[model samples]
Target: MTEPLFKQIAALIEDSIVDGTLGIDQRAPSTNELATFHRINPATARKGIALLIKNGVLYKRRGIGMFVSAQASAIIQERRVAAFAATYVAPLIDESILLGFSRTDIHALLDQVAESRGLYE
Candidate 1:
């Protein structure tokens, strides 16, 4: 399913935060700039920005512009981790159950995959 425009915009900003393209107290693109750059409606961009502000990922200066919150990256990371579990881990477990795989089997399989990818060290 396609994500909503506002959510996509929010995700974009979150990604920027995670990747260090945006840092704490750094100014964010203006709503108009986001709208123009993404070819989206200004209102949609504003709504996305508002979500960040509400979630404490961003704050506004009196007249300067929006800036990343001091803890924006941490906030974004927490949200993304929760979302990842919901979006991927839950479904993987459900599918494994439907396929008659035991929990041990799943763990072993994951371990094997991680070893192959050099991630089990």
Candidate 2:
């Protein structure tokens, strides 16, 4: 609960969209459905849905319900990549440079770790 419940709700839905659990144009669970499932207030769930709508991750279908946007996965991926770079890569690079590590050193270190961890397919 480091973030607000509504934000957590939005992230949960975004995770599903990004992981292909929820495909493009798929109807997202309704506000009531989420609220019921999570035992939260409907208003809180609506706030989460509203945040997604504002971000274009989800779109309303008039009288129907909210659906995944065609670019939902791409949008989530782009945003997440930028966030990951800012939060992790940037700091790591700055620290590595301060510690006298060159760009090549960083690349070698990363590759070594990736190889050892079976991260490279």
Candidate 3:
């Protein structure tokens, strides 16, 4: 089970925005609605929403509701890519070292896979 409820919520919301499941200028679900929908606490929902707001993914409209920012998808994508690299790469490097693999060996294998997949840079 995922332990970080707020972070999981944040990722779901961010993915919805980035993938156009949620649209620009569209009002997001209310905190109470989100809480109910995800079976989480209202405060947890608020934390997720607050993170998006701080990251410029959403904005409040006084007493109306929270709306997705025009640049929400872009911001979410940037954040996701950054987080993916940090989350995966550091652990991968540590694991490779523990498995008796050198950095150069890993880089060569990564390049091979990238080239095979036509993702080489």
Output the number of the lDDT-best candidate. 2
Model 3, runs deviating above 4 Å = 1-3, 90-121
Query: In order, what is each prediction's RMSD in angstroms?
Result: 2.0, 1.4, 3.7
Residue by residue across 1-121, what tens digits does model 3's lDDT show?
6658887888888878877888999999888999999999999999989988998999999999999999898888887789888999888888998999987999898999899999955
Tens digits of per-residue lDDT for model 1, 19-113: 99999999998899999999999999999999999999999997999999998988888988999999999999999999999989999999999
**Each candidate: how many clashes?**
0, 0, 0
Q: List candidate 2 segments past 4 Å from native.
A: none
| Model 2 agreement with the true structure over 27-53: per-residue lDDT tens digits | 999999999999999999999999999
Considering TM-score, which of the candidate structures 1 and 3 is the better prediction for this target? 1
> Judged by TM-score, which candidate is best?
2
Q: What is the lDDT of candidate 1?
A: 0.94
Per-residue lDDT value at 21 in model 1 = 97
Candidate 1 clashes: the total is 0
Query: How do the predictions measure up, each by TM-score?
Result: 0.86, 0.92, 0.72
Residue pairs that clash (backbone atoms under 3 angstroms), model 1: none
Candidate 3, residue 88: how far the Cα is off, in Å: 2.0
Backbone clashes in model 2, listed as residue pairs: none
Q: After superposition, how far is residue 20 of candidate 2 from its true place, in Å?
A: 0.8
